[model samples]
Target: MSVWDDLIGQEPLAHTLREAVAAARDRLSGGSGRGMTSAWLVTGPPGSGRSNAARAFAAALQCRDGGCGQCHDCHTALLGTHPNVTLVATDRLSIGVDSVRELVRSAALMPANGRWQVVVVEDADRLTEDSADALLKSLEEPSPRTVWMLCAPTAEDVLVTVRSRCRLLVLRTPSPPAITRMLVDRDGVPEVVAAFAARASQGHIGRARRLAHDEATRNRRREILRIPTSLIELGACMVAAANLHEVAQEEGQGVAATLDAKEVGDLEAIYGASARDGRARGYPGALSTLKKDQSKRRTRVVRDTIDGALIDLLSFYRDVLALQTGARTALVNDEVRADIDSLARRGSADSTLRRMEAVLKCREAIAANAAPLLALESMMLDLRV
Candidate 1:
């Protein structure tokens, strides 16, 4: 119904935000009796809607009626066109000092709309040390009328100094039933499909959405889940590994290419528009900066894709091991029960557990800065008899 309702399965966070709204409202009515808190840090796992929570909170702060969906302030805030609400979102790998400096300058200004001047940084984990230090200085002496909300995967992501100064909001991953209900209620997906996506995604909201919306994503997941039963030979394992890598890379590229092109196009237009009469001596430096940023973004996109695929791969082996040991709990790949059953029958529980270990080791190698191709190849080889 309302924007707040769209933040699925975060009841505690919703309650806390509502309280903040009430506090701010009370302060407004009583001539700053207790005053508003200057900063908030919202943290959660990937795909858990931490940024969305911050946006909803911003809407609440802007709304005279505390996030009334029909009000002008709520509407503008939600659409990201509000005069006082600033949201910093980036697809780039890191937030550099320049961008953070710009935000710091904006933070110094008073609210044009006479409400809270809210600044929401969506990916605070990507802020470099310099950016974080700049942000810390701003937070130390925040304007009386300003509010800063930062979202990251965990408190450890930001500097301890920064984290210590902010109110913390921890969001839990939504349950499968909650995800399934949302899919059926919001997206009009079929019951079976919603349940399948919900179970397979393991509380990842974006992945569940993709599994429901994209036939290809679901099909690829199904194909990956079948790898355990299909790995009958050494060559088959390598082929499967290569296929997984390519699929992940393709998906990552698909996600990044358009954004990358748009960013480069915008940068070029800015430079080219000002490059009149062949006086653009700094164009090369600008072009180089753009290229470097693009390359970093590509790496981040690939890493994200690989992370998703790794989860899918991990779930399949986990399901296999679960079935082999008769865990009696629900499987992550419940939609592919038949395939899991077949794999369980073909391999002993110990062997399946070993395969799961190999998968985990592959993940560790990647995290430890090993080449993904070589690490994955070795993991696949280890999975063979």
Candidate 2:
């Protein structure tokens, strides 16, 4: 097995990275790493496996056999447990200056394995302006044995200066068939369920897995898909919008439940504070900071859920448009073709396009930190036939 085994729909990209790994090995043996560099910027659409690509490359670089999956070097590097590997994946909304400076310090350290010190950042696009600026100097003049691998949703998402210092590689969305095959073969998901999840996810690998594995996730998606059919009166629009916000918040909370408690527990342990104790000295301010961070995290999570809901709606309307135009494309929501047909018969192609535009606008507004309920209400009204 190879580290690239799970990277579905990216055979060409895998080949490129393998070549880079060979060049990197040559560099370690006192030759020039012509095809590889100290810094790399990896960009891709959401769920295109950008982080996975980074981790796989990191493993390949550290592995003596160039990412043979059975090797200890490969296993540890992929798990972020290798002495020479550092993985930066933030739970917070943004990566600040302090975190970047800390990484810079780590990047300067010597490799314990005598190969390379690899740092893989899974969300480089979330870096704050100050953090990007702080990261600039290290990227501009990287250490000889230090490799910085950054992942972002797009090239434009990173600072031009930092981006310019790194070799750029872009990943494409995994085709639905590719995602379905991975789920069926690797995860043992049922073929039918895997197919539906893959088509519904529209190339997002993580969500497809969730949809395949979790019944509650499927139920919630079903509820959201039924929203358009419920938009009858003004009151119905208001209700539908409110229900969508609640649904997103509920989904977000499901994720936050475990993570939030663990964070609090870790903070209490660090400060030697307990619920039974009156309080530890300086704990209140630290607790306040933790609360703020948790709040920001919750907001971002809910907003992301809302954005996902909007995208699902976009797919529904797009199907309606496809039907109205007599296009023979397969529907993303083929299971609900009855409802789709009803919607398409009632609406013109122009109206379907307009509704899709509304969904796009709502997604943009929520991402820009607008009030979720308000934006959703406006969008629901626009979606009404």
Candidate 3:
């Protein structure tokens, strides 16, 4: 298997990256690196494998045999352990100026063992204004042997200045058939289960994998989709809002559990504060700062979870609209076709469009830091049948 094997339905992109790798190899072999780009901005929808592509490209550039997956160089490069590769993936809400400056410093170095010094930033969209500015000069005047690959959901999500200085690599969402095939072949999922997950995720690779394996995630999604059919009364709307909020909180907490505990324990040790000892002198402030960071992280996770639920709700209404309009496209929520038919019988296409608009508005409101429960309540009322 090559480094590009996991990049399903992206043969065009892999070909482009392979050409660049060949050019870089030419330079390493004392030829001009024509057609090779030193800076790259990888843009794609969520789960479209932007970071994965970047990692593959990085590994390929450093590999003599062009990312042969069996080699130690390929393994280490993919894992970000190769001496020539730097993977900047942050669990924090945003990348700061300090971190960007460190990367800038690293980008100034020559390659180890006469190869490329590769840097892959997994969340360029999360770079703060200051950090984005810090990254500008290095991108503009990168070292001859240094390569930078930055990933974001869309080109618009990244700073314009930063994006303009780099070559663009866009990834497309794989089709359901493609995704289903991959789940069965790679992850050894049952065909029926893989098909369901592929359709339900709407071609989101990561979510498809999760839904194929995790019963809890599927159950929660089912409950979320059930809201559209259950919003019969004003009281029911509020209840739905509360349930949505609770589910989002649980999702957020689930994501935070591992990293949060590790940080708390590390901070406690640093402050020398334990159950047996009294609070240390500077422990309170440090702990308070850590809590603030964790709160921001949790809020982001919660909002993202709710946003995902909102997207699912949109799909439900889309099915209803399709039925109402006598459209031929298959329902995204095929398992809920009966419910969708009932909704179609009860509402016109115009009403379905209005409800979808309301859902989109609710997503925007929550993204703007509005109270999630309040936004959800407003949306649920609008979605009432």
Candidate that would win on TM-score: 2
Which 10-residue window in model 2 sums to the lowest lDDT? 271-280
lDDT by residue for model 3 (1-385), tens: 9999978889899999999999988988889989899999999999888988999999998888999987988999999899989999876778989989999998889877688999999999999999989988889988888899999999999989899999999999889999999999999999999999999998789899999999998998899889999999999999999999998998789878977888878977777635225457777777777888888889998998898899899999999999999999999999888999999999999999999999999999998889999999999999999
Candidate 3 residue pairs that clash: none
lDDT of each: 0.83, 0.89, 0.91
lDDT of 2 by residue, 1-385 (tens): 7999978799888998999999998888888878877889999999889988999999999889999988999999999999889999987889989989999999989887788999999999898889999998888888888899999999899878789888898898999999999999999999999999999999999999999999988988898889888898899999999988998898678878968888888878887735327368777777788888888888888998888888888998888888999998999999889889999999889889899999999988887889999999999999987
Off by over 4 Å in 1: 31-35, 273-281, 346-350
Model 3 regions lying over 4 Å from their true place: 267-288
Location of the lowest summed lDDT over 10 successive residues in candidate 1 = 27-36
Per-residue lDDT tens digits for candidate 1, residues 304-351, read 676677788788888888888878888887778898888778889888
Which sections of candidate 2 miss by over 4 Å?
273-281
Q: Which candidate is the best by lDDT?
A: 3
